[model samples]
Structures are given as C-alpha cells and as structure tokens.
Target: MADMNFTGPEPDLNELLAARPQLGLHAQDGLCLENVPLNAIADQYGTPVWVYGAQTMRARFAALRDAFAAETVPMHIHYAVKANDHLAILNLFHEQGAGADVVSIGEFLRATKAGIAARDIVYSGVGKSEAELETALSAGIGQINAESAEEVDMISAIAARLGVVANIALRMNPDVDAGTHAKITTGLAENKFGIAAADIPALYARASGLPGVRVAGIAMHIGSQILSTEPYRHAYGKGAEMVRALREAGQSVEVLDLGGGLGIGYQDGPGLSPAAFAAMVRQATNGLGVKLMMEPGRYLVGPAGLLLASVILRKQTGKRFLVLDAAMNDLMRPAMYEAWHGILPVDAAAFQGMATPADVVGPICESADQFAKDRILPDLRPGARVALLDAGAYGAVMSSAYNARPRAAAVLVDHGGFELITRRQEPEALWDGEIVPGA
Candidate 1:
C-alpha cells in the first residue's frame, strides 16, 4: 500500500495534551493519556491494557452537574454507559448521584447491576429489540427516548402486553446537523437515528394519550465525539421551539434533551471543559422551563481513561513507522476518523533521548491500522511504554477481536489504587459457542 502524504501545521501533541484537563497531570509527571504509573502497572499487569481513573470520572460528572445548578430548571447528569461499561465506572457515577443513559438492554442491565436504580435508567436507541422493551418495563425504567412513531406505538403496545405503562420521550430530530465526524453525527434529517421534527408532535400525541405509556418529555441526541457547542446551540434552539409548539397543542413538554456531543480534545485537542460546556448549555435553555437530560458518552469518560501500549518495533529508512502492540482492533478512531490522538511516552523518553518524527503505527495486518501517520516522538525502542491520550471515552468500548487477537484487559485506578475491572479475553473465549454445522 502507498503511504498517505503528511505535511504542514500538524498540531503539537506534547504541548496540547500537556495543558488539557483530562489529559493533564501534576507538573513533571512525564505522562499523558493514562498518566498512570505505567512502570508500576507494567510490572504488575503487563502492557497493552486499559486503565481509568475513577476520581477523575467523578470529578468530571460533578463539574458538569454543578454548572447547571443555577438554571433552577432541574437536571440529571446521566452517564452514557456505552462509553466504558466497567462496573466500577458506573458504580462511581452512581455514588455521585448520577443516573445512567443507556442505549441497549445490556447496558441497562449493567447500570442497574452497578447499583443504579431502574427508575434512573433512560433508554434510547434506534433499533431496540422486543425483549429489551419487556426487560425495561419490568425493570421499571424511568423513561425511553422513542426514536420513531412505530417505536412509540411499539413501546405502548409492549407496555400494554406487560400490564404496566412504560414512560416515554420523543427523540426529536431537529435536523440540526451536529457538524462533526460523518461516522458520529446522527441528528441530520436523513440519518437513521431519531424521528423527524415534523412527525414528533403527532407521535407524542398518540403515545401520551394512549393507555399504556407515560409521555415524560422530549429527547434528542445528535451524535457523539462532538467538539463544538454550535450544534448544541442549534439543537437546543430548535428543540425548545418544538417543545413550545407541542405545549400549545395541549402537550406538557417537561423534559428537554440537548443530546450529548460535548467532546473531549483528542489529536492536539484544546480541552473541552465539562464545566464550560455545561455553562454554554445553561445559556441555551436559560428559560425553557424544562428539566434537561444530556446523554454524554465521550465527554464523561474520554478524558478519564487511557490506553497503555508497549512499543514493539520502530522501522526507519522509508516513511518511518513507530509500531506498537495496540492496533486498530484496540483503538479504532485513528483508522476510522483519520483521528488525531496525542500519543506520549509513558517515560517521556523523547525528552531525554534523540528526537525524531515518525508515523505511530500498530501491529495489525492491515496498512490502515496506523494511529498517527506522521507523529513526532523521542526515538523509541521496542520495550518503551507509551500511551494514547484522550482514550477514556471511545477507547476500549470500540475495540474488537480482529486478527483473532485477544482483547486487552481493562483496569481502573482510583485514589492511587488500581483494580482489574475487565479481564483479558482469551482467543478461545471468542469461540464460546463453537459447534460444527454437521454436529
């Protein structure tokens, strides 16, 4: 495969993550991404692993929640469990009095299992299974962000079958293009996510007036990994407008969901502070007179976690490549988004050793498994440990068993103590249900 061209004005990873909140550490810490004591973990649990800071997760949630307290409209900081489904992380959010915004029944189970009450879980997804509906209703889930008119009917019908009315919310697609990566944006008119704005009113009327459903409010989640607040402004403005129209048509639109796109800085990211993003949101819905629900996936956890990998090889001569044990299967954003994630030496060897610019690639068989096509690094050897910065959100959650490589183990570090949250997967574990067709 041919090498992609790289030149001009590339961001300074060393300086950017050095100052960002989620990625920043105490001065002279000499680490980014995990910023954990890599030497300690490597000796204890080995490399190519994931670790999260529980205290950081709690702090970020509290920061976002506190920012909107002045609104007087009431709010719930629902942790989108899809980001990192570790029970420790969910339990931490629970202890902070946060709720869970789940997209699937599995996540629903995880939140509840992690001590979150069923009433605190809010389910939202485009294609939900029927069993998921029954499970939520039986579990007494607080609300459902219904994405379609059919889903509205289905939820009502499912509740009817279960003899309990399910709480519901209309996931309105204000058609606000959350200007972000194409793979993550979902609120546009044609995206297969929420229902169109034009049809939400009638759908709500049907669900609210129906016998087996409680119309709680309106919800909208445009996309994920969103860095700008402009899309949120557009979403809230348009959503509030819809809420007003619905109220005039004899509907009490009590909840307004701006949908979480508040992104953490990755790839020379200029930190997106939770407090700042929340304050911006506060200004948008200042007098909307509705309780706000934000389904944040990345912002809540992205900065709190890091993926630690060991450099396996460094090739030079032609378009240099810094190969690491972590591949596309480990963190897919690089290959998927041409994304920029600040990669740092756990030891800051680049500072003490010779400096050079080279592509940080992975050991994956494919050429696309490269993390940074041309990144500056302090000449690395095979054993030096490095980290992928701002990986707390979509990092481990998106890893796959590609190339039959066993998924890495996941851990959490809190109060300077560490615990293994998810065990390393074995190759045979992937074939848990193996059986010959003839047999």
Candidate 2:
C-alpha cells in the first residue's frame, strides 16, 4: 500500500514503444503487437479484450534459458502457473521444455490438461489440504515444497497410507527483504510462508526418518517484483549454508528450488536481468552440487500481454476523468496492488498528440476502481481505444465478475496472425448456476 499517486512529467509514448519491442505504432494499423493491429481485435471482439503475444513469450523463455546456460548452471525452469494459468500459455512453456510450478490442485490439473506431465509439476504452497495432497500424490507429482512441519507430517501420513514415498524440499524462510511490495514479500520470518532456518535441520532429520517422505533439498522465495539480485544472493547464500549444514548432519540434498519473483519493468525502466540473476545464483551456490530450479512467473509473461479497452466517455469537472469500458473486474492489479501499467492510445495520431493529465478509471462504482491518477495521455474521444501495457501476467487471470461484468475475450497473436484463445463470457453465464430458492 505505497503511495499510489503518480506526479511527474508524462512518459513519452515513443519511449514506451521503444522499451517494449513487441509493440509498435504503425501508420495504418495504429498500435500493433507483433505487427498485429490491436484495434482490429478490439473492433471485432468488442472492447475490454485481452491480447497476448505468443512470440514474445517464446523469446523471453529462450532468453532466460540461455542466460542460465551461459553461466553453465544446470537450471530447471518451471513456469509458475499462478501468474497466468491459461492452457495456451502453459502449453507454450511445455513446448520449450519447462516444467510447471503449481500451488493448487486446480492449477496442477490445468497444467496437466495443457499436456505438462504430472511428474514435471512441482507443488508449492503454504496450505495444502489432505485432499489436495492425496490428489497430487495420486497423480504422481514430481516434487512438493513443504512449507511447515505440520505439512511434512501430513504428507508423510498420506504417502504412508498410499504406500508411496514423497519427494519434498523444505521451503526455508531466509528472513531476507526482497525490496518489494509488503503484500508480495514472502521470505521474511514474520511472513506466513516457509519454515524458519532454525527449524530446518531438525525438520530435515525428522522427515528423513519418516516412512514415506524423502527430503530432497531446500526452497526459498523472498517476494514478487524483485528487481535486485542482492536479496536473492542473501537468501540463496542462507539456503546454501543450510544445505551444507544438512549434509554435515548426514542428510542427502538433491534439488534447490529457487522460487520465482523476477519482476518486469512496469514503467519504462529495465527489469531484472536474467543474466545478472543467473550469475548471482552461480556465485551464491557455485560449489553446491545440487540441481538448480527456478519458478519464474511475472518476468516470463508480464510484458507480453495487454488489456484493450474503449473509452466510454470523457468527464471534466475539477478533475478530468477518462472512463474505460474495462473495469477493476477485468484487471485488478491497478486497484489491488496499486500497480502502474503504461497506457497508450491505439491510434498513431493519438499517440503523437499533446498530452494532458487525466484520472483514468473504469465504470466500477467503487472509487478504488481507478486505474491511474493524473496520467498524461492524448484526448481520447468516446469510442477511442487504448492498450494497457505489461498486463500479460496477473491481469485477466485475476479478473472477476464483481460488478456482474462478463469476462473479456482473449486473443493470442503469433506467426503474424491472431486467434481467439478465450471467447468473451456470455452475460447469461454469470448467473447460470445461481438459484432463487423458494421463489
């Protein structure tokens, strides 16, 4: 809940376009993602639609994979499914030889449905119910990152009953600050995320003696939207020390799950460099012979998608308000995380126009539904279209029907063409399962 207000000179539209190469302004097509005009999609599917660039995702995955390869680290990349759990996105990562890092059974099922083998999916969450553990164990999940001692015992009992050995890593809370938002930070001792470092040695020893549990290694995740590698170095250094301690105490360690929080540049600034991150991991855990695994969510997909919305109308009073057809129900990050996403006009002329400050908002009744405060943009008349940039992750996947607004349609742009990945939710579908009892 940091200061949400933005007070400064407007970001240059051309500069924004330059930062994200996937997007460009065309003379005839206006704003194009991977050279596909966004306005065409908005016009055909109606406004309040989501457009994702498949090529962009593929390039990002390659970049991260190659970065680790350059450092000579045998890294296993797991696509964090919670960020954007669309089957198309999951399948694309699977094709790139990436595994799935899921936190829930539904996400696990979704990853498998996308053709990701259950054995390639690693379950990580603070709370895993008995049913969920049974389901995951029944499906032969590859690895589970146990958060608490109780969870370890729970997994042990369930696995013993099923007569199967479970492969798990102790998720250690390194108490390192990731210099991110308060809500997203998970590595602190106060955060209810992982087991404390002091408890790991004893837990590892205890779990090793259990009937159906095997202590693979350790896992640690500090936070989301992390820009610096120093926090990771601190956390990973602690993890390495714990690994050594466990080994010294006669324990076998195998895999080190480096939880993902590699952030993207929300504004025009540079994001966390994969090369720098890989180098830091190398420097921190260089001598440890354990296998390296990273679960990256935002960094892989956040910049590859956008929300296309049409201007409902422009209101002017003491403050200029630009109302959009898309509401908080469509993209909640702006209201939920107070996140900043670059907004650009779909028309080339509008992009070149003189900018003025206006409060960009959705039609939701709540005041918190505002997307941007005092954002500078061109005079977008009614029916004008705009694209909210860097919304590929934590955008549509987090959407809801709070105001009874049906979810928006989704299109995937690839190979110089676009196709509907998810059709817009019909209005009647909202209440399809509801019942007016005793009417």
Best by TM-score: 2
Writing each residue's lDDT as its tens digit, candidate 2 over 125-209 gives: 9999999999999999999999999999999999999999899999999999998878789999999999999999999999999
lDDT of 2 at 7: 37
Of candidate 1, the 10-residue stretch with the lowest lDDT total is: 1-10
lDDT of 1: 0.78
**Per-model TM-score on C-alpha atoms:** 0.92, 0.98
Question: Could you give me the TM-score of model 2 versus the true structure?
Answer: 0.98
- RMSD score of candidate 1 (Å): 3.0
For each candidate, what is the lDDT? 0.78, 0.92
List model 1 lDDT by residue over 356-378, tens digit each: 67888888899889888666678
Model 1 earns a TM-score of: 0.92
Task: Enumerate residue pairs that collide in model 1.
Answer: 267-340, 302-393, 350-378
